[model samples]
Target: MDNAPLVIDVAGINKRFGDKHVVKDLALQVREGEIFGFLGPNGSGKTTSIRMLCGLLTPDSGRGTCLGLDVLTESAAIKRQVGYMTQRFSLWDDLTIAENLDFVARMFGMKDRSTVVDKALDDLGLSGRRKQLAGTLSGGWKQRLSLAACLLHHPKLLLLDEPTAGVDPKARRDFWEEIHHLSAAGITVLVSTHYMDEAERCHRLAYIAYGTLMASGTAVEVVTGQHLHTWEITGTGLQGMGEALRALPGVDLVASFGATLHVSGKDRDALEATLKSRLRDTPLKMTAVPPSLEDAFIYLMQGSQDQFQG
Candidate 1:
């Protein structure tokens, strides 16, 4: 991964609307053929940042290159080489799957529109439903059709904005499989998602909150970088344990996971001491466990100050 050239490299990018600062000095570098995951809470500017990178919206300030073209000057050229799938399904719902693909091909001005459309249908497993109305299809099928349209231009870079928001688990898995396949074929992908499992699938990940970048690295690195200590507590009647733990000093997070409670804190010794002292008379079992990506994700979100709150 270190040997690959950067497909998307930008720094100090900022954007604003009226008095609201949307994205503030955001910087990122996505490697060639890499699946870089972009994660954040809702209203965190993930979508806006994506637009700036893909030439759909220009950054208010900052300078960098995308696909080695000047982001500030050659946005049109960048847009041509990049395929973007929006968070919402933006395709024509009244049109059939095949017709949608044909329309996208026409927009790209491909001379061999028929051949390109046919190949796209087959590639994304949409051929069987080529005549199906996009609006009439289910969420998974619509997702497949959106992906097919994105690839019709044969773009070198793919910017997917939560492509699986409402998709089923099976369809999400299939979409990710296709993503990995595309990466192997040397198509760089920059995707935004809220799912931790999907974030772990990427070669690297970046977490943003309130339009600010808080962390970026491999899954392990991001988890370890937080230096958080976590303990799993299991026992009967664990209902009120979370509230009790949250009130204690040194306990930063207390989340319930099915049959167990994951308690985490930044101060290791203090957290351990508090847990032992509080639970010594109880029947609960406390076990030291490694901090997970989700733990780190929540931790980051908790620490971030919402820009709109003021």
Candidate 2:
């Protein structure tokens, strides 16, 4: 993996919409055949950054190559080789599943369109519902159809923006299975998602908050990089305990997880001392625990300065 050639390499990229600098100086490297997860809060420039990487939106200032083509000078060629699935369902709902795939193949000027569409349908398990109207399909089916369409032209790199949003757990699982299969076939994927479980599935991931890249690494590396010490407390007054934990001197994160509260801080000694003192006479059970990926995510997000906020 260390020796894999980078399929998406860009640096010093910036984009602005009027006075709002949407994406700050951004730098990223995604290896070929790697599933690179892009994660961030809403309005954090995930979409904008994805567009810039895939050639849909030019960076205001940057120099790099995506698919060996210059991002600034060869965006048209870059668009041809990349498959981009938008956040929303962008296909024509009036068309049938088969019709949608066939139309996309046509738009790409693919040879033997019928054969291509047939294989796509069979590959995605859409052959049985080829004639079903896209609008009548459930969210899962629609998502499958969207993925089939994206794979029609056999793009080298796939840019998926929250492809599993609003789908059932089973559907999301199935979709990830397909993604892994594609990665195994040497198709690089750059996917943006809000789900922590989904982020963990990626081979590597980067967290961006408000146009700034906060962290990029494997899940374990990211979790370790935060240097946060965490404790899990279970008690009857977890809600009240969480509030009090947030007010302590060293506590930086206090989040509720079901019946337990995950309280974390950068200063382990201070956090432990404060908690031990606060729960000295209480019945609450406290145990030192490793911080979760979501803990690191929230920590990174909280530490970032949102450009929109005054």
Worst 10 residues of 2 by lDDT: 301-310
Query: What C-alpha root-mean-square deviation, in Å, does candidate 1 show against the real structure?
Result: 1.4
Model 1 C-alpha lDDT per residue in residues 1-310, reported as the tens digit of each score: 7789999999999999888899999999999999999999999999999999999898999999999998988999998899999999999999998999999999888989999998988877778889988899898888888888998898999999999999999999999999999999999999999999999999999999999999999999999999999999999879888999998999998888889999999999999999999999999999999988999999888888543464
Per-model TM-score, in order, reads: 0.97, 0.97
For all candidates in order, the CA lDDT equals 0.93, 0.91
RMSD for all candidates, in order, please: 1.4, 1.3
Which pairs in model 2 have colliding backbones? none
lDDT of 2 by residue, 1-310 (tens): 8799999999988999999999988899999999999999999999999888778898999899999999998998998889999899999999988899999999878999999999988887778888998999989988888988988999999999999999999999999999999999999999999999999999999999888899999999999999999999997766677887788888999988899899899999999999999999899999999999999999888888533464
- Model 2 residue 85 lDDT score: 93
Give me the candidate number with maximum lDDT: 1
